[model samples]
Target: MTLQTQLVLRALLRNPAHEMYGRQLADETGLMPGTTHPILLRLEQAGWVTSRKEDIDPHAEGRPARRYYRLTATGAAQAGAALAKARRPRTTALRDLAGEGGTL
Candidate 1:
């Protein structure tokens, strides 16, 4: 997964029960709307996430209702696995040399 994808997935996973809008998700992930929206779309298409328009009256709120997103059961499991793997430490060249008592 790409960095953006990982960030978005983790953000959603953090609030598995709550639905978040695109802008809110972007804010939470420190990503601009341009990056966040596309990732949401792709995740929706892939069935990892789902979205729906909020049932609010625009006239009452004086603004358009927003779309909200949440992860599916399968998505949560997949994201959990991905995040676990991502967090694992990998041995790099520097680390390997250090292990062999070499200089940095």
Candidate 2:
């Protein structure tokens, strides 16, 4: 995973039960929206995350409804394992892949 992807995963892992919106996550991760949104799209595509639009009327709220993201049960487990592995020392082959931001 890229460092940006890892940051997003780590943030989600910190509070897996709490659903956070895109901008919220971007702010928390110190990443720009251009970076964070695509990472979220990929994670959702991988079945590691799920999202839903906030169930409030945008007009009444005077803002767009936020799309909240959270990790699935399997995602939480997988993310923990991935993060652990990413923290460990790697062999030459794995190090090369890591440098390229390859997936776990």
Candidate 3:
């Protein structure tokens, strides 16, 4: 998966039950809306995320309806594994770099 996709997945994992809008996700991930929106669309298409239309302000003119995203079961599993892998200590590399001084 691409870095942006990974990031989006991770964010979703962090708040699996909380529906996130695209703009909020973009803000949290520090990605531009252009980049974030496409990634979200792709994830939704891939069955990793489910998107739904949210109630919009009737008073707001010309604004598009808001869509919220939530992680699918598969997505949650994948995100958990990814997070574990990312959090795993770099023992091998650290040991190699430390040479004789390192603890196995």
Which residue pairs in candidate 3 have backbone atoms (N, alpha carbon, C) closer than 3 angstroms, thus clashing?
A: none
Residue 14 in model 3: lDDT:
88
Sum up the clashes in candidate 1: 0
What 10-residue stretch in candidate 3 is worst by lDDT?
A: 54-63
In candidate 2, how many Å is residue 5 off?
0.4
lDDT string for model 2 (7-91, tens) is 9999999999999999999999999999999999999999999999988998999999999999999999999999998888657
TM-score of 3: 0.71
Q: Which stretch of 10 consecutive residues in model 1 shows the poorest summed lDDT?
A: 88-97
Kindly report which residue stretches of model 3 are placed more than 4 angstroms away from their true locations once superposed. Answer: 60-63, 83-104
In angstroms, the error of model 1 at 54 is 0.9
Please provide TM-scores, in order, for all candidate models, with all chains considered together. 0.81, 0.85, 0.71
Model 2 / residue 70 / CA error / Å? 0.4
**Which scores better on TM-score, 2 or 3?**
2
Question: For model 3, what is the alpha-carbon lDDT of residue 86?
Answer: 71
- In candidate 1, which residue ranges exceed 4 Å CA deviation? 89-104
lDDT of residue 96 for candidate 2: 86
| Candidates arranged by TM-score, highest first | 2, 1, 3
Q: Quick one: how many clashes does candidate 2 have?
A: 0
Error of 3 at 74 (Å): 1.8
- Each prediction's Cα lDDT score? 0.90, 0.93, 0.83
